[model samples]
Target: MQLHDFYLSGNCYKVRLFLGLIAQPAELVNVDLPRGAQKRPEFLALNPRGQVPVLVDDGQPLVDSQAILVYLARRYADTHWHPQDAFSQGQIAGWLSLTANEIHNGVARARVGLKFGRPVDLEDAQARGRQVLELVNAHLANRSWLVGEQPTIADVAVYPYLAMAEEGGLELAPYPHLNSWIARIRALPGYVDLPRF
Candidate 1:
């Protein structure tokens, strides 16, 4: 597999975390987002959206981080990453969707705004980020993992930027349960630190 992505991207980091945990090594092709490498005609031919995290396997490109996660999980029979039970499966899927739509769009984008030159709506973004954090905290309060008593692709899918919410000006103080969960994930064998976090 060849993963073409911006190295600093959380979306790309999700795939890296999964590959690391699954012990599946792949060729990492760094895409220079700031340099508009993803927008180039050659790269655009692979994914018109010109997004980071375009995974090419057997000459077939898989765009979208969530889709790549499902593909890797299924292809490797990654049982721990994606379980077999229907209910648990739904739970994972729900979280994956939230990671893509809510977490990535809301918290991550807000952080990028503040990090880059863009003006950040601090109040609005922080409030929404806190809301998302609270929801995650609630789900994790009594559980060690997101689904099926183990860390799944769902957990790996959302863990990167979230572990560094403070970067977005979202404090970690209120989400003790989530903080603890972050520690648990970090202590895992194949855990890799995100550069910003």
Candidate 2:
């Protein structure tokens, strides 16, 4: 197995975090984003979208962070990480969708703008991030995990950007429940720390 990765990318970090949690070993192939290596012909062949966090398992390329997370959990992790029941699977899928859409557009995009200097409205992104955080904070107020009792890919998928929201100039101080949730995730076994900004 191998992963095309970018060190500063939260999407890439999600895959790495899961790999660590499951103790799966894979080669890390760094894509030179600053040099536009993702747009290169070789990289584009792996993912036409030119994104990182592409996992190649048994020579089969899997694109998108959420897709990669689902694949990893289902293929490698125990049932606890990704339940097999219909309703549970659907609930997890919903969170994955939220990670791809709301989390991406809000927290991740804000970080891209503020930390990476992307051409985005930082204030708008941060404001959107706050709204998303508010929703998540309320959702987590009475629950330890997103879907059920134990942690799932939903937590892994949404964690990175929210953990690093400070880089996006978004303060997490207002969300005590969310902050505790972050701490809970960090306390999980096999938890690996991503590079801090």
* Per-residue C-alpha lDDT of model 1 across residues 20-120, encoded as one tens digit per residue: 87788889999988889999999999999989899999999999999999999989745878888898889889999899777876688678877764676
- The whole-model lDDT of each prediction reads 0.85, 0.91
**Highest-TM-score candidate:** 2
lDDT value for model 1 = 0.85
Deviating ranges (above 4 Å) for candidate 2? none
Q: Which 10-residue span in candidate 2 carries the lowest summed lDDT?
A: 188-197
Native-structure RMSD, model 1? 1.4
Q: For candidate 1, what is the TM-score?
A: 0.95
